[model samples]
Target: MGSYGKLVRDQIPEIITAEGREPITYIASRDEYHRRLREKLTEEVAEFLSADDAAALGELADVLEVVHALAMSLGIDSVALEELRQAKERERGGFTRRIVWTGNR
Candidate 1:
């Protein structure tokens, strides 16, 4: 049996397969996965900054996936962090408005 981390990584292929499509899900003996992630982040950041709504949404999803991987690496539960965010939003305010930065320099 593979380790928990390996199992989690392996699930990427299984998920793609379940979606009625084929995808290269294995990162074995390759750095392509990390490279693709970096490329996706770059694309998303560009789209987000350009105010492309659809692309921004896609990029946000990619960013969330990266965050999930980071959380998994740190043995942290992402769901708990999301819940904390929700709680904080309730206590304070959600990201509903844009804050304008006045020249303070």
Candidate 2:
């Protein structure tokens, strides 16, 4: 039996093969992935989108997988990328506070 992560990783290539063309999978899956990512981002934006927390978490995992694939294609290590994220967080305040818009509506 494959590990859960392995099974999920295998699905990408399987999806490609089942579609019988690279573009089909890329187009379909990428759009689906983009939609889900957008939903998650929207939730974060509004601060009231926790109804699909589990689903959103899964979508986030999928997004990370896609991003990891892209980074690998471009010869980037995920760990190094994360370190860069940490560095950025150090330079800028992290997302722990809410922004208040007090200007013109």
State the displacement of the C-alpha of residue 103, model 2, in Å, after optimal TM-score superposition. 6.5
- Global Cα RMSD, each model: 7.7, 10.0
Index of the highest-lDDT prediction: 1
Q: Candidate 2 lDDT, tens digit per residue, 4-94? A: 1112243667677778965222332554444544554444434433437756766665566666655554567899878878999999868
Which sections of candidate 1 miss by over 4 Å? 1-47, 99-105
**Candidate 2 accuracy as lDDT:** 0.56
When summed lDDT is taken over every stretch of 10 residues in candidate 1, the lowest stretch is 1-10
Name the regions of candidate 2 deviating beyond 4 angstroms. 1-9, 12-51, 100-105
Clash count of each predicted structure: 0, 0
Kindly provide the TM-score of model 2 when superposed on the true structure, using C-alpha atoms: 0.47
- Tell me how far the alpha carbon of residue 81 in candidate 2 is from the true structure, in angstroms, after superposition: 0.5
